[model samples]
Target chain A: MKKFFLGFALVSLLIAGVLSYFASGDPDGLDKTVEDTGIAAHAQEHPFAGSTFADYALGGDSKFTGLAGALGVIVVLAVSFSLFWFLRKRPDAR
Target chain B: MHMSDGLLNAPVSVAFLVIAAVGVGFALVKARADLDDRTAPMAGLVATFIFAVQMINFPILPGASGHLLGGALAAILVGPYVGALCVTIVLVVQALLFADGGLTALGANVTNMALIGTATGFVVAVALRRLAERGKGGLAAVAFVSAFVNTVVAATGFVVEYAIGGAGGVEIGKVALLMWGLHALIGIGEGLITAATVTSVAAIRPDLVYLLRGSRKPLEVRS
Candidate 1:
C-alpha cells in the first residue's frame, strides 16, 4: 500500500511538473462564456492576483509554469496529507 | 467554476460563505467515517491528483477550454465525504496561494465545485452502478456518466448563484443557456479523463477505489 501510494503521488507530481506547461493558453469554458456575454468586465481582480504563483505563473512569467505547478502540487500534498493524517481513525482508541 | 470577487454582491457572497462553512464543516466531520489509517493517504493523494489535473486545460471549443473539476473523479475514487473535503482543500489552496479563485468568492466556488459537484457525481454513480455490468468497463462507464452529470449540475449551481446576486447587467436566461451549453461540451472532457483515470486505478489496485467497494465483480488485479 505504501508503494502504491508513493507511485500514485509520483505520477501526479510528474503530471503537474511536466504536462501542465503544455496546457492551452485559451480561456476556459466559464471564462469564454463570460467573455462572450460581456460579463467578464464585471470580474474583479483577485486579492492575491499579484502573488508569485498567480495565474499559475511564477513572477508572472509563463516560462516558469512547470515550476509553479510542481510547487502547487507540493503545497497541496503537504497540507492535505497533514489534515488527513490527524483525522484518520485510530483503532487503538477502541 | 471559480467565481471572481465582483461577480456576486456582498450579501450573496456572505450568504454563500456561511453556506460553504456549514457544508464544509459537515463534511469535515463526516470525512472521518471514511478514513481509516490505511485510507487516509488515499484521500490526500486524491486531492493532489485533482489539483494536478486541474492545471491542464484541454480545449473544448474554438475559444473555450476545460479542465477537470475532479469532484466526480475524487468522489468515485474516494468516498463522497472525503472527496468533497479533497476538492475543498484544493480550492482553498488555489484561492489563497495561487489566486486561481477569488478569496471573497471562495465560498461560492466551494459550494459549486466541491459540495454540489461531489454530491451530484456520487448520487449519479450510485444510481447507475447497479445497472452497470460487473466489469472494469462497466465501472468506467458509470464513472464517465457520473462525471458528465456532475459538471452540468455544478454549472447549474453557478447560474443559480448568479441569479441570486449577479452584479452584471447580463440577462439571466442568456447566462444560463450559455453556461449550460459550454459546460455540456466541457463535461465530455471531464468524463473521458475521469473514466480513463478511474479505470487505470481500478485495474492496478481495485481495492483503493471507493466506488467499486460495493461491487462483487472479483477484479483480477489487486496489488
Candidate 2:
C-alpha cells in the first residue's frame, strides 16, 4: 500500500511537471473573457508573484530552474500524499 | 475558468467565497459515507487522471484553446460531494503550485467550477439516469448531457462575474452572449470526452460510477 501511494504520488507530480510545459500561455476562458470585455488589466498580480516558484519557473533561466520546478512538484506531491495517507490510514477512523 | 483577483467585484467575489465555503463543508460531510479504504485511493487516482487529462487542449476558435474543466466528469464518475472536493483540490493545486490560477480568486473558481459545475452536473446526471433507466446506451448519453450543461453553466458564471467588475465599458449583454455561445460549442467537446471516459469506466467497473448507481446491471457479452 505504501509503495502504491508513493508511486502514485511520484507519477502525479511527474505528470504535473510535464503538463506545465504544454499548458497554454494563451489566456484561459476567464482571462479571454476579461480581455474581450476590456477588464483584463483590472486583474491583480498575486501577492506571491515575487516568489521564485511563481509562474511555474525557478529563479534563474538555467536548466536548473526547470529541473527544480519538476523536483519541487514531486516534493509537494509526496508531502500531500503522505499527509492524506496518514490522516486516513487510521484503521478505526474510517 | 479561473477568475483572478480584481477581476470580480468585491461583492461578487465575497458572495462566491461564502458559497464555496458552504459547498466545501457539505462535500466533506457527504463524502464521509463514500470514503472507504478502497474508494479513497480511487478518488485520488480519478483526481490525478482529471488533472492529467485537463492538460490536453482543444481549439475553441481560430486562436483560442480550452481544456477540460472535468467537474461533470468527476461528479458523474464519483459522487457529487467527492466530485466537488476532487475538482476543488485540483483548482487549489493549480493556483498555489502551478500558478495556473490566482490565489485570491480561489474561492470564485471553486464556487463556479467545483461547486456549481459539479452539483449541477450531478443533478442533471441523476435526472437523465432516471429517465434512461431501462434503455441501452443511456448512461453515455446522460454523461454527455451532464458534462455539456456543466460547462455552459460555468461559462455563464464567468460572464456574470465580468459584468459586475468589468473595467472596460463593453456591453454586459454582449459579453454574456458571446461567452455563452462559444462555451456551448466547447461544451460539446467536453461532453464527448467526458462521456467516453465515464462510459469506459462503467463498462469495466460500474460500481465506480456513482451517478449510474441502481440504473441497470452491467452487460456481459461472452464470446
Best by TM-score: 1
Which predicted model would earn the best DockQ? 1
TM-score of each: 0.97, 0.82
Across B91-110, the per-residue lDDT of candidate 1 in tens digits comes to 99999888998888899999
Across all models, the iRMS values in order are: 0.9, 3.4
**Residue B68 shift from truth in candidate 2, angstroms:** 1.0
Q: For candidate 1, what is the DockQ? A: 0.83
Regions more than 4 Å wrong, model 2? A1-25, A57-94, B130-136, B164-166, B219-223
* C-alpha lDDT of residue A35 in model 2: 72
* lDDT tens digits by residue: candidate 2, B109-151: 8888888889888989888776435333676788889899999
Which tens-of-lDDT digit does each residue in A1-94 have in candidate 1? Answer: 7788899899889888899988977888778877888888989999898998898888899898888889989999999999988988888876
Clashes of each: 0, 0
